[model samples]
Target: MLLANVPITVINRTYSSEHKLISFADTNTLLEICDKFQRPFLHFWTTEQPTLILGINDRHLPNLAAGLKGLAVNHYDYFLRNSGGLAVISDPKVLNVSLFIPTATHNYSIDQAYQIVADLIQTIFPSLTIAVHEIANSYCPGKFDLSVNGQKIAGIAQRRTQRALVLMLYMSIAGDQDGRSDTVAQFYEQGDAYRQDRWHFPKVDKATMTTLANLVSLDISVEAVEDQITTALAAQENAIDLSSAPELLRSAQFINEQATQLKKIQLRNNQLPIV
Candidate 1:
């Protein structure tokens, strides 16, 4: 089903420089909202700090310590995400979106969830010829990587609970795409210098990645893209501002549950040796 067919609560969030980790906690809280309220959510968020988010497998790299040290030496903050996919960069210039849909009524297939985000992206940038395929040697390469003229500009990943699914996407809207890719490449190079691990990490190539600004003639800002997205979804009559519902935020149960989820996220991140 198209996204327009579902009623979604829209949330726009910005995190402080030191609180980028809270973004993950917020997502977890939204999952709880999905379970309790049985409502879909479309969350858009950005962080003031540049972060190198590693996936579950990254913690098992043969020389993970050396890789994390490299990131620190380069003045980059790194964390392990409780999700699948290799390392990817998230900064002020990158736009992160999550679509949380409850599956209690409709069992959306994996491909269907991916296609929903792809369709939304296509609606946002109609001028570009978007392709859905793995861009070899690109950071966080996946079958659903959204590319323009063979260079990846965005990637999609999925996380599901018992009753809801969240499709997470990170789009390189405006920034030094090459620098971001190079950082990830170097991390993998240093982390698996010996190449002895059974699981192969990507050998990221900077040329295989491009930002949305580079692919289009228009000047792109995160806010502009966000406005366009909200406008598009609103036109379809599928969006409701989550902030308008003050009762949800003021609920004691919500406050306690969100705090618990945040603590869990903190614990998970703290368990990583890099911390």
Candidate 2:
């Protein structure tokens, strides 16, 4: 995990200092803040409840029927994000962040953006215990997964809109990875297994998935992890703002629109029981 260092260039800013440690109760609120910022923001967020988000182009997910039924989950609340990745595991204990960056080039790629954020994360965990490698056989497998040596601790995704790039992330601070993994594994196992083609589904290694609490050994601790983020940000030349309700309301509206469109598709295909 990389820490913030003052860049010598005047055209750039190590803007991580301007980030607000926002505690969002809903994913929609997280989405809205990204849309409302100027100097770009990296929001460390969380959800009110356990939720599953699918990529808009993820049409090959399997076992969706059994996945929804097995959860006793209400699909009305599920949203299909207009971004990349299949499904991500997110919960209250998890620390999720979205970075809204403005790229001048029209051909900005997700890999380029993920590299910038992942590098910062690697700096904080210099032990290199948190491996910055793609955890294959894992849900939403990507190049930017923050793994502990061989195990996965965090995952990152990219969402862009109107030239604004929002880098979405899900960090398992302290929760049941086995439980989260089960949900994802089960979603594919019982939901729509019959629909899977040659494509592989998100894989979760129960043994490998870990939290910050589980990672702290002797010299490094969870408090250290917390301290580092604060200390690292404080050492920088930036300020963080608390998100407001007005931003939340706008987030809810975006969630509604995304979920509504997903509901229609899920109902038509018998993927979700919401309709």
Candidate 3:
């Protein structure tokens, strides 16, 4: 309900921004960037190459070959993302946005983060028929899925490091939800059937999920979503471009150390690594 209270002042910050999404064959570089940049930024890009992203602690494989590679699904690779949440489909269409908000600016609980997203979407389509409620039985179900008529349109996850909290979520702009759910369901099945461990996969439903393009009766492209994010973020602060930062470059060794230590200690209570 507070979605509209996201001060227009923040939205009016630097009307022009240079936020661009870069593709990845592996998530290591992205993770490195996220850990290194202690500021707010956004991007929307995807890989032409397929990589089956495993949860940080999703080791139903237990060091065994898992995902498409193990099943010989052809051309698909398997690697872990340095974050929370289970598998979902990612490509150019699944527009990904990361907002690294300083805790000092606003203390964010999970709900507050979702509210920020809800507010942004509301800004884009102020009159669109939609609801920001939890979608039950959806893949990676969280409190922040923007839905329409009980079908999910997004899944959100937050990654916090020290005082900076990064909320990473996907707006499935155009894709086969049923197809993506099938891939996740099969991955869970394979990981469970092949490895001798009890692990939980996101309960994805082919019918309960969809994309923004599908949610609205309009034809939406990933490029459109990218523009919307640039707009929303520009409203927040005088965003600096992602130019080559020597200081950021110099901090890599230390950043990697922090990341490694975080991952090593994150695997508690039988949970997978966060990446």
Using TM-score, rank the candidates from best to worst: 1, 3, 2
Please report how far candidate 2 places residue 65 from its true position, in Å: 2.1
Worst 10 residues of 2 by lDDT: 8-17
Write one digit per residue (lDDT tens) for candidate 2, span 1-275.
22122121111111121111112222333334334442344455445567666554345655454565665563212444545568775555666665556443333566777875676667676766566778886777778888875778888877666545666667777766678777777766765644665766654556667776567543443334544554444445534333443353356664575466445444533443452
Query: How do the residues 72-180 of candidate 3 rate in per-residue lDDT, one tens digit apiece?
Result: 4744444445567666566556665655455544567777776777777767766566687677667667677777778877767776655556566677788777777
lDDT (0 to 1) per candidate: 0.82, 0.55, 0.55
Error of 1 at 139 (Å): 0.9
Candidate 2: misplaced stretches above 4 Å? 1-37, 57-59, 73-78, 104-109, 217-236, 242-272
**What order do you get sorting by lDDT, best first?**
1, 3, 2
- Candidate 1 has its poorest 10 consecutive residues by lDDT at 1-10
Candidate 3, which segments miss by more than 4 Å at Cα? Answer: 1-38, 61-66, 70-75, 193-198, 235-275
Q: After superposition, how far is residue 20 of candidate 3 from its true place, in Å?
A: 16
Q: List model 1 lDDT by residue over 111-178, tens digit each.
A: 98898889888998999889999997998889999998899999999988888889999999998899
Among all candidates shown, the one with the greatest TM-score: 1
Against the true structure, what is each candidate's TM-score? 0.92, 0.67, 0.68
